[model samples]
Target: MTVYRRGLRFLRARRRAVAALAAWSVVEAGQTFLVGYALARALDEGFLAGRARTGLGWLGVGALAVVVGAYGTRRVYGCVAALVEPLRDQLVRHVVARGVREGDGGALSGLTQQVEIARDTFAGLVMVSRSFLFTAAGALIGLCSLDPLLLLVVAPPLAAGVALFALTLRPLARRQEAFLVADEEIAAHLGGICPALRDITAAGAEALVTADAGARIGVELRAARSLARRGVLRVACLAVGGQLPLVLLLATAPGLLAHGVTPGALVGALAYVTQSLLPALQNLVHGLGTSGSRLEVVLRRLTPDPPPAAAGPAVTRQAAGPTAGGPARPAAQPRPLGVPVCADHPPARGPALSVSALTFAYGPGAVPVIENLDLRVPRGAHLAVVGPSGIGKSTLVALVAGLLEPTSGTIRVLGQPVRGRAAHGRTARGGSARIQPVRGPTACGQRVLIPQEAYVVTGTLAENLGQLRPRPVPEAELRAAAEAVGLGRLMERLGGPAAEVDPRALSAGERQLIALTRAYLSYAPLALLDEATCHLDPEAEERAERAFAARPGGTLVVVAHRISSARRAARVLVLDGRRALLGDHDELVERSPLYRELTGSWSRADSKPALAPRDPDRVDPVAGPGLAGDRRHVVAHGPVGQMQAARDLGDGGTRGREG
Candidate 1:
């Protein structure tokens, strides 16, 4: 259902309170008319007459009824206000949930602001409308009963005033909307400044950012002024218009009384019309001017054509088809523990990744970040991707991490298609597999990403690390992870593993170490290090690279900007623009011009071609082999020699490294 329809439903559900309030307004309007009529009658009859007593009783009764009506209105408004709090709360929850689900924080924030304005402003507007109609109807009926001719006096001016308001309100609303948009931009700009402050100051660009923000605020102020001017003009017209009829009545009432109209009737009708026009016009102005504009903003924001829902029964039915290269079958209904995953049975205990022709674009109109990308990392192998900045290197890493979907083609985690939704659940192939849909450690329970900046929140080190799971990781495990990456000494200097190191005091490298430690704590089958080493020094990089190399089973896809990092990888993939190719570090250095340019590999003089490792097994069947490189030994085999051959290869320094 449309949001406006839903909102209307909500207001309608509170019909009991609305009815009570409307009833109170009717009583109040009736009392206003009665009081005016009583006063006019009393004045005309003269106070010493018995008619004065009758009029005084009505005046007192009218006063009492007004008090009761005010009290009832306040009570009903309170109930309505209470009802709306929960509605605002619901909108907040929807926004939060949408942000977490779709990663659309900006849109969610806008939606939340719109819903709040609607709730707060709409209630006042609806109430005011109720009061306005009550007063206008009561006044018109009383004036008609006294003398229908007065309707002619009020209607023409009231219509003119309404037309004037409507004509001016369009520009007022447009200006108001523009001001609000600018104000929101200013707020977002200020919010973003904290992250960019260091960069801005370092680049001497603080003035530029400040100037930009000031310009936006200046525009907002101008628009606000324009809106205020229009509002003033509208109010001026409404005020003059309301009083015109009253003035006309005063001049005409005495003449009508002279033409055999009772003085009591003329005065009573005039007073009633005066009382009604004053409050009714005022409330109508408020409703149309301020509240009306705010409500329109709310309605516009809340009534966006909602995107099609991504989850539910219909999606499940669609999932029963050839997806991820599997035959069609009914999707299971059981929700996964985390992000939902659906695919074939993953190969038992294989390397954590495979990608073939993985193409992805951020949006429909944007250029494909990674086009026809092919990458594979063997089980327990470390591979680094290096390229120039903006060469889609980060995009490639994100794909391997499974944080983003390929626009076309396929990605497989351990031989299972990592397409559609990835998590552990039923697949179109009618089998269950563990696929982590969302990016993080929980998916497949063995994947982790150490993002570049390594965010640190305001909390104890333990608490930040503890964000990985509900429970705190043991100190021993934390230390082990830290020690694996050369953070042991730092941890020791900072009062050991239980140390409550304030993140603010730590150097960038130190914070990065903590981030790495968090990643290390996850025994994921795959790890994507996206510039994870950027903040580290050479020594720390060496240590971290070694630690990553030592990790077994999981595939390591590293996006590195440094040649030092490329040298440590079993293989290096050079991405130039949207293209990628695989080769050993030196092979890529020699072959790929982009790689040579990036690493300054051409600078080396008289660098000899590195020799490929040799297998001596084919050389001789019986004879024992001689040593080759450092700490090398070789042996050859036979029936008794077979035993010797096993010992020889094991003792030899020929442990293979595959690229």
Candidate 2:
């Protein structure tokens, strides 16, 4: 659906509140006319008839009713606005949640602007406009009821005034739309520049960036001036268009009175004409001026309503091949491929992870990022995924973490499917991330993935560390996480992260360390470190690695580019062209060419020959939990035996390369 249609849906959702506000608006308008007429009549007839006190009392009663109506209307207005807040928040949350998976931009900012505009204009100014309309309608109806002939004199000019105002303001509306778009561009430009101004200075490109900003501003200024001109011309047209006919009416009023129109009727007709024409003309001008931009923004923000929720694989079947048949049977749900089974539920303990036939692509047609990728990470294992850049190493981590869905595969963390990204194959920006955040009661507090980039929110360091509100982590625990990542000294060097005062005050490394602390706080059974220590020094990186290794019960999946990190891994999976070459630190180093080239030493333990498999049914004591339980399993088949078996499957085979 288009944004405009979605906006209408939003309005429809809050119809009751809107209706309440609209009802009061009409009541206020009618009362306003009544009070005006009553006062006018009291002065003209009662005072002129020498009954001043009675006339005054009649005016007071009319004034009192108007006061009460307006007061009640204002109260109702507040209630309507309050009711609309949740609707606005819901719209924003939808956009934010979608953005996490889809990486779509502009929706969040536009939603904020639209809701604020609605609160300021639609929720408030609309009441006034509606009041004006109803008030004018009542006065015009009363005037016509008193004397139908008077319409002939007032109707033509008022219609002309409205028509003329509309004609002149059409251009203004188009210009305003263009101007508003340019204004948004300028805001985005400034926002981009503000945070990274130091880089421009360091690079000596300040003049170039400043010139770019100036050019954009110049464009905005020109459009803004054009809008101003249109506004002025519209106001001028309203003045002349409204006044010319009113002047004629006033000039003819006395003559009309003498020509058999009663003076009281003439007076009332003139009052109605003035009241009816002026506000209508003003509203026509204002509507053309304001509504277009507000609406354009509102329409841009609202996404199409989602299709109805479907059950399990049925949903995917409907999405994948709708014409194929009746509802497709749900795919056999696999157990976890990694630990920290639940993000919300506190885990009994972290567990090691394993995957088989883990294959996934972006879509049906694209080549898979991971293809039949298989790995066995023992319980409490600290393994690193080392590959040349762009080798799908990080993507593998994402898949294992359940952040991406496999095209054909199974991942078992402590013998359960990953609860995060993998199960549904969703990215953060597509609005699916929130669902993955809490998968099931048995799945909570199972695993945490530390992304490559660091994020710091606008609050205290404590706030940034624990995304969950009411901050479950204590100061001591937070300090320990900081120290474990070797950021404790950095914190002290910077005078304490808790008192660091601002995220801006820290460097990129410090920010990344803080993010590490956040992941550590999650205490998941499996921690997938996707370049999580990319920012730390060698000593600090080792310190962070130890922290991951020491985490209770969870297996550690580390994706690293640095050879130092690879050497530290108990087992390293070398990926090249989306295929996995798995072996221990020493075994892979000697046999795999890619390992040697990356580490630059054939004799290094990281470059050892791939290990030959041992006999079937001979379990290593260190392997823990064997092939049967929640722990990762090395199949009883010898290394060479399993390797041949995997090759015979006719899927991609694991091959060690000579550098």
Candidate 3:
């Protein structure tokens, strides 16, 4: 129904062309009727009465009608072009707009593949639908004029065939939609894996990838076969509807003659069945069956719900809370130190981060990973978040970074509320609730997030480092930031910032260090590091953490992978799957069992530390002398560095004994 409405609207926009098409269709239908009438006169008045000249004269008039009909058909094609082109343009504009808003690859497929299908299908549908209507009307009139009894014999069967065909339309459309969905899934799967082929090969996972692709292909194959089965039913309907009427007329001719049906009228009736009714019905079955369904699907996708308002009363409630209405209630009272507060409390002025009653789940029915969580970090605060693997640490960070939408809540950064939907009572409602990525001054230059695995593109070191900046950073600043993160030696070895390097050539630790330096130079007001230093040595990790925290007016939130990172932070948040505990390191060690257990396990695992304990009087090399001898030492300095150092000392002792 939407497609029909939208199509009618489009046709109205080109009213002149549609009007012309309608005029031609009328002319075409009239010509068909005149030809059948002329043939009946030729048979009855000339040939049966033995006047050959008169029969030939009637035949010539029919020939003239055919020429006029040809001209009308030509004009109809022109009108079809006028209508289809503008519709295609409208569809293209809609598809492009959706692609920009959603940034989905499926939109690209729709734009390229589905739009073309809609255009072609719509054009064919217009021509066939117009022809069927006018021709069926003209044929019915001619049958009446020829003999009213002929209508009784042919009309009932004709109507029944058409009704049967109509019944198949919905099922055929459903099958078409299913086929398209299966095809899109295959395309999406292929697109997802193409860029990861190298990693798949390195992991020796070719068989697994092949199996996955094969399964998607199998689904597409089944859908295609189902669609084909539906198409066969359409053909059966066309044959019964269009061809069966002619067979009945021929078989009943002798009985009709005895009942006062003339031979000339019977011949005319044959002409009406063959030339007008049957062909029109055939075109309707083929054109409407396939194209009508495609047009419906395409229109629904092109027209989506309008975006929800950016700010609303619900958003105000989530951000500013009950105080926005009147005086604060008893529920707004501040909790004890390190205890999470409800959203009713006014946030600290100029807070770098604020979260109020946040909750998120992967989908509507899934268990929530974060629930009624509240957090605030003042400007320049250094906070460390720690949790066991899969405790939703990454999910939390992603929500804050605007990579995922929270089911219910509000997040504000640097006093500006991040845009999203607010939770109302117990349930979350659907709206334009997704928070757009922060940008401009509000984003605070990069708002950098360094993940556990660093990203390095194919480019010069300078270009890669300058990714966060709108313009190229000065050479001095680049060098200083690189030296601060211990990438100075690596930079020099690779021939400075201008040198091109393959990201794959660098060790994971080195890549993480480079990412750290990039963040250091970004000068973002807020930085989130999610286990970013897990691949680096303890000393290097400490230096990187200190550099980020030392940035002027910047806030740092690290998803700590080590107890050392937690100890360095002013406040630590320990997530234990079910609940989150927030406190200073010493307080959490005393009060929180999960924190104490984590630190105890860390201490046991790192019984003998390699990187010397923090002491103002002691100075250590950025990298020890044996770093080149064993790369694993550079990766982790606790146990691996000690083993490497002991091996070097053992080699020295053996040489001394030989001397």
**What are the lDDT figures for the candidates, one per model?**
0.60, 0.59, 0.70
Compare candidates 1 and 2 on TM-score and give the better one. Answer: 1
lDDT of 3 by residue, 380-450 (tens): 89999876545677777766665567889888776656543121111110000101122243223324567
RMSD of 1: 19.5
How many clashes in each candidate? Answer: 9, 54, 0
Q: lDDT by residue for model 2 over 1-659, one digit each (tens)?
A: 66557557877887877677766666665665555466557666777678888788867877786787778677666756655576567767767777786787766664667656654554444544555556556766666665656656666666676566667655776787778888889988888777656433322235557788899989889998988887787667566656665676688877776776666566666666566557655665676457755655554545555777676656332353334657665543322122222335543422467788888777899888678877777787888887654457767776766666668878777666764432422111110011112223312445566664455545556655654212355556667777666667766775554563365566545766777766666545677777666445557777877777776665678876456677888888888766679888789878787776766532233221122323233321111111111112222212211212222234544532111
Off by over 4 Å in 2: 2-4, 10-22, 50-54, 57-61, 75-79, 103-114, 167-170, 193-211, 240-245, 269-284, 302-659
Best by TM-score: 3
Per-residue lDDT of candidate 1, residues 112-148 (tens digit): 5667777788777767777777777776776666556
- RMSD of each predicted structure: 19.5, 21.1, 16.4
lDDT for model 1 comes to 0.60
What is the TM-score of each predicted model, taking all chains together?
A: 0.46, 0.42, 0.51
TM-score of candidate 1 against the unseen true structure: 0.46
